[model samples]
Target: MTAADFQIDDREGGSVLRLTGDWTTTGLGSGARDLQARLGEGRVTALDVSELGRFDTAGALTLVQATTEALPKDAWASRPEAGRIYAMVETLERQSAPPPRRPDALTRTFAKIGRGVFDIGHEMLLSMAFLGRLTTATGGALRRPGSIRWPAWFSQGERAGLDAMPIVAVTNFFIGAVIAFLGANLLTQFGAGVFTVQLVAVATLRELAVLITAILLAGRSASSFAAEIGSMRMNQEVDAMQVMGVNPFQALVIPRLAAMIIMLPLLTFIGMLAGFLGGMLVTWSQLSYGPSFFIQRISEDPMMGTHLMVGMVKAPVFAVVIAAIGCRQGMSVAGDVESLGRRVTAAVVQAIFAIILLDAVFALIFLELNL
Candidate 1:
């Protein structure tokens, strides 16, 4: 009916606050604090709000605080709504509440680092467990070689090794040629250009061939394996196989692993042959020596056997690591398109990193043994 306003009436026991107009917080005027301070200066007895127009929490609190510690019960019983709120406000103990505080930047930074480390450890543990399962499955299949699934093995071998031949051939050939050219250029100044043949042969056989092949498979075979197995997981086909008393490892994982184990060494040999030819081409063009002389130099090297053995031995190990990571990531996939994509990417990254790490370890071991 009217704009919010109120007045204080001084009384014997305390004060009788009389309200009129709209007594909401918004319209209580700039004098709201002054009125509250004056009301709280001494004792207050009761609030007479019979003439009140509009009332809200702000006005209710103002009326209640104006009253003394021993506010009369009869004063509040008159208006049920405002009285209930004012009574509730009176019981609050402001001193008991504490303010909220935020964590500092350093604390948050350390927390994030701790979480990241924990996630890495957790993932490594999961991958290791999967590797264990695959190892056991491989042994179990060995007892009955028929479980190895020769068709899948042949298919995967063709897919990973044969199908990948063109890229590996072209790339490694150029790499070998580049190495030879660079070596020939450096050695020509000293009349030692022929040594470039031995350099290309030993380095390509001992490191570059297998290393490049493994990296390629990490990207190619790993992503393909993850995608194929992840599709089965997403479609619930893996579950279906389990229900039918079929071991997915025997049917899927073993064949892929077997294929990789057989194929990688053969691929490495092919890469080495192709890379040698490239180096031979470069050496012949630069040093006026044909492939016969290049082959003779490489053949005369005493360490050639050691280099070939070292490189060939690493292939199967790298193959298993890549295939295991790929299969693990695939089987871990959740039944969603996004999860399948994520797992596939993870498979490639994990496989490549593991291969590089394993290769480095092998290098150190061989160096220590003087191989």
Candidate 2:
């Protein structure tokens, strides 16, 4: 077969592209580039394929792409196969072409912001809906105590709370120690280093213990719930349960929710004690305050019990938010690995965010009430 070539003639009407030689794979080497370059020099108003030889799909594609104008009908009269190939390749190229250019940068940024706001609103609505469903399910279980899954509740409690005790205890211990160190360092300058006892006691009992424990559960238990339920979703097990006249919310969600509600407060109590011990040890080692003196100082603090009660009050709320976010994200997962992963991540993030926001709201309400 001859090498592909094209000749451009300056005709009276306009330029004419006359394709020649073999346009098959091996024959079309430089011809594609030469044809494109010639076409770029000036627009060809007419196409001539009369003398084209040894044509194939490759040759047709080259000819179709070399000029902007459509192939003349008469040019393909002598070569109907070439015409068919050209038509096919031309249609495919048109279908595969890139989309129109994107909006300008400012417009894109505004669009992104708009989408983000919409997503946040949508997510809030979904969460509220989930909470309503959870409340309804809980009411149903309360009406018929036999529907409550005690075994599942115990199992989830063991996993979410009992297994998490060590990390929560250790983390809060260090947090309390750090608070003691900072308080002593600052108060010593004002001849008030002894007040460090009150600082650690109030901080740990009122905020640190509960907040830290909730954050830990948000990361650990929330992720676990999302992944477990998301896997169930991906496998269509949740669907099967519905078909079998089962309520997934009762079997799967309520137990976890009950577990979190019961276990988080217990964990927070443990964290508060651990934190007090840690602070006591730090004060004994860093300052000259003995364990007896530390204990005495904390015991004498009038607001200590109030602080403890306040912290305890926040746990159930935090528990509900964390468990609800996790279960909701799990239920939202599509039948895919990517959706499962995304939902798991979103569970942790949304739980943490809700925990912090709720904590801030609690702080405001307590402040207003002079608590």
Candidate 3:
């Protein structure tokens, strides 16, 4: 390869660089070092690479290494050609690597178990810390309830309740229909078709409604809480609050948690009603069961109230879990968009897991009580 000819000149805001002919390793290195030196002196902000040149990997590597090393870590590079340099490096790194060794089945199983235990421990510790902080802040707020921010509570309520109603309504309606259809099909075979009404009512009021509502709140409200708080963290708003002598947990977390705790029960109730109505439609229209007969069957079932009560009780607990997980994950977020994304995802996953675990606990308690 022939040596490249290049020219550097002062521009209106930064340096202008032009290249001509073929770029040899030495020529490329010289040009890259010069640019690096200019950047070190804080004199260069842009480069003009539009001039004619025939370059190989050495030339590309020189540009890539210089750009990567010279610029401030946060500085943006908008060069299209420079992308090729990074891509080539990445491709080479991947292609030159050996295939990963697969673990034996027992090793993989043990690794998974170990990871699960670690994750559970980490989550528990974080949750305990968050709850401790929340309790401290809440006690302080209770001492001066008038000092508690009302606007924040209203905003959170609106977001967690009104904004989430439509989707919750649609989903619960479909879920009710599905349950009724499945029960009707199975029970009809046993000449117990009339029991479908009790099945739909008890299950919808006690389990499906609350569970579905909790999951929706986890996905929608919890994720939103995490993302909002994470953004505040990234923007240093939480630090600013601290500097201003504001309690972030009281101002942020309490309001959100309170809103969720209050609204979730109400939403679950609404979901239960919608689900029951959907089941009623299927039973009365498709199954030819009269509305009176459905209502009578539900009322006559002694265990119906037990299921309803179980579901209703689960709602508040689920809300608490969802809010706590979201707030904890959000507070843990580092100052980056990527960290925010990860924490938001974690919030949803953790909230759902916690909800399911709590439901299981409730189920065991109810079983023990013979309810």
- Winning model by lDDT: 2
lDDT of 2 by residue, 195-282 (tens): 9999999999989999999999999999999999999999999999999999999999999999999999999999999999889998
Residue runs of model 1 more than 4 Å from their true location after superposition: 1-103
- Candidate 1, lDDT over the whole model: 0.84
TM-score of 3: 0.71
RMSD of each: 7.2, 3.0, 13.2
Number of clashing residue pairs, candidate 1: 4
* Tens-digit lDDT track of model 3 for 1-371: 54565566876766545555555465554555565555444354555555545656666555454443332222224445544554675456445778899999999999999999999898789889899999999999999999899999999999898788888888999899999999888999999988889889988987889999999999998899999999999999999999999999998999999999999999998899889888988988768998788888888888877787888888889988899889999999998899999999999998898888888898899889987
User: How much is the lDDT of residue 229 in candidate 2?
Assistant: 94
**lDDT of all predictions:** 0.84, 0.91, 0.81
Error of 3 at 270 (Å): 0.5
Report, for all candidates in order, the number of backbone clashes: 4, 0, 0
Greater TM-score among 1 and 3 belongs to 1
Rank the candidate models, highest TM-score first. Answer: 2, 1, 3
Q: Which whole-number lDDT from 0 to 100 does residue 214 have in model 1?
A: 90
